[model samples]
Target: MLKVNKLNKSFGENKVLNDISFELKSGEIGVLLGKSGTGKTTILRCINGLEEFDRGEITVDDISIKNVKDINKIRNKTGMVFQNFNLFPHMSVLENIIQAPISVAKISKEEAVNTAKKLLKLVDLEDKINSYPFELSGGQKQRVAIARACALTPKVLCFDEPTSALDAESIKKVINIINELKNKKIAILIITHDIGFANEIGDKIINI
Candidate 1:
């Protein structure tokens, strides 16, 4: 469902990604691993159209993105979760998820709420619907973030060190949630420092 060829990205003088090439079919669990400064996160941002590349091509489901015109189209097929939860503190959990669908997905408010609730249940957070992001623990907040991402129901789920800030218990819980998503046939790409989890959960690992 995703193809990245000769992808090169640099930040002025620093080169992060060097001719990276990879292909992901539907339902595949792929992992990208490297040192702290490598282009792992940048690669994900590029795929989701958050970071523009210096060169190379990225295709999601045969749709090529080389200009601003295809940015939204490519992003609609991809959901990215950052190391930081990046949740809006002022918004409630349900509001965080529902807003995206109603505004970006263009679904009706009622429809978006219904879908958001179902997603919360998938992440086992149905009871915390009315909770604000600050009201939840790191793991709970991360799960809410995951639920929000899944609410998009994108073709691919890209996670960047999702459990980095969580405790041991929280990390395990997050891993379990990701495993479940993998089983449910969501294409998963994780850029993480958790090598053990990568070995256990990833179908393929690319170490830069």
Candidate 2:
């Protein structure tokens, strides 16, 4: 579960997020819909501890982001899929998926590989295990990114403009992947301007 209360964020004189408040519960998909520069991604960043908020509170599964001594603990529980697939250009798809689990989750390489393979299958990227980011299509790369995020077994997953870089068909694939994730009971937060995509998957839509 994720909750944001009266969340306010600003950069110098510019106020990005204004009293934004919402809650996302397990097995539910929450959508943040607004035009560009409305701080949808900022809300995700603050929740992930990637950006510090000036005011308000964020908690993931009841753990306060502000009070957490080890931010990595919060990050481990919250997985973020960036607008651009932030895959390692040099790493293979399999490698990318396994990296976080082995390094951050302290799982064995053999175990991580096994889990990564399963996740790849879930995202329909098992066939491209050895492929690099450059060799993959936009859809394949996004699937890999999703696989990488799911590898951590996060309680909540945040996707920032997931369909922004894809074609119509690719967008469908990504949406299907997201739809599948709902059955896993993980809270999902999607930040996007794509109303059709949001309506298709969102259990609750929060307009910013």
Write model 2 residue lDDT over 37-60, tens digit each, in one string.
Answer: 888888888887788787777778
- What are the runs in model 1 whose C-alpha is more than 4 Å off? none
lDDT of 1 at 10: 80
lDDT of 1 by residue, 1-208 (tens): 7888888888999988889999887788898999988888888888888888888888887888765346887788889887887998999999999988888889999999999988888788999999999899888888988988888788889999886888988787787888888777778889889888888788999887
> What's each prediction's TM-score?
0.95, 0.95
* lDDT for 182 (candidate 2): 83
Error of 2 at 163 (Å): 1.1
Q: C-alpha displacement of 49 in model 1, angstroms?
A: 1.4
lDDT (0-100) at residue 26 of candidate 1? 73
Superposed Cα deviation of residue 79, candidate 2 (Å): 0.5
Residues forming the 10-long window of minimal summed lDDT in candidate 1: 65-74
**What TM-score does prediction 1 earn?**
0.95
- Give the CA lDDT, 0 to 100, for residue 101 in model 2: 91
